[model samples]
Target: MHPYLQIMIGFARSGVLGYGGGPSVIPLIEYEAVKNYKWMNSDEFGETLALANTLPGPIATKMAAYIGYKVKGPLGAIVAVTAHILPSLIALIGILTFFYSFRSSPFISGMVQGVTPVIAVMLFMMALDFLKKGSKGLGVRWAMILAVFAFLLLQILTLHPGIVIAIFLTSAFIFATYRGRKTMKQNFEQESREKVQ
Candidate 1:
């Protein structure tokens, strides 16, 4: 089989499995592109996931584009993105076409209720995975604590998600920059020591 074909199929499957949108898609894409395909390491995957979330587009598209670019450049990105989108597009069209026909059914609503809790569980697991990474750094830990507080405030004080996102993003950006500067400084000192020896 052609490598590009494999890449497309990989992305399509990931998209199909990622029913809860972008955040849920991360684990699936990571499994295929990083673990199975060996296209990148976990750290690279994590960083790309972070950067993608900050960008404007869908997380799935960003991931497909990034992985595709890494593998086969511009054309690869196109192929991966199209593949990721096509399955969902087709499924959505099909469902919408039939939605009115099923609108009055209790069965459909029951299925939706059943699925919601499962998706919630999946998201909780994903959060734990991120928290494990946050545990590695004091800044990350504190930032996460602040985020939780802000979230609680949003719920209790009736603050909007947009406001919460702004605060969280601003704080995260500052903390990440500080952590990056510290890493660079440590690297510079290590390089200087090596040169002296």
Candidate 2:
């Protein structure tokens, strides 16, 4: 099949099957892009996921757009975002209607209860994979520190995740840019001194 079609079908499939919400859907998207199609390696997918989290809207949609653009540019992005959203939108409308009618249904309630454990496990495994990737790129110590910091922010302090993320992004960017400029200035000074000698 063509690459563009793969983008549509992959995201559409994920949208259709993505139970719970955006976070739960990540493993599905990762599987579609990384495992099933070989569209990107795990590290590339991890980087995309990180970037997607920083964006304003839904993570899955952002990832779909990125993958589409990577493969086929603007039109591909449009196709991917549309396909990714369409299934969930339609399903939501239909489910809302049905659920309103069957709000007291024990089977539906039981199904939801049954799926909770599976979703938890999936999320845990995905988090582990991401942690491993982070460790590889940032070193184990920094990765552990980040994980501990995130846990304290969300679990203990009860801060909004967005606020925590904003703090981290802001500080990391400012410090990295400052350090880069400082290193460049030192290098330039050293070169000038050598030239004077």
TM-score of each: 0.73, 0.83
> For residues 1-197, what per-residue lDDT tens digits would candidate 2 score against the true structure?
99888988999999888898789889999999999989899999987887677678888888989998988899999999999999899999998898989889998899899999998999999999989987986899999999999999989999866678778778889989999999999999999999999
Q: On residues 59-122, what C-alpha lDDT tens digit does candidate 1 reach at each position?
A: 7899999999898899999999999999988998898689769987998788778777777887
Error of 1 at 66 (Å): 1.3
Candidate 2 accuracy as lDDT = 0.89
Worst 10 residues of 2 by lDDT: 160-169
RMSD from true fold, candidate 1: 4.7
Model 2, which residues run further than 4 Å from truth? 174-197
- Given candidate 1, what's the lDDT at residue 127? 68
Q: Evaluated with lDDT, which candidate comes out highest? A: 2
Candidate 1 global TM-score: 0.73
Highest TM-score: give the candidate number.
2
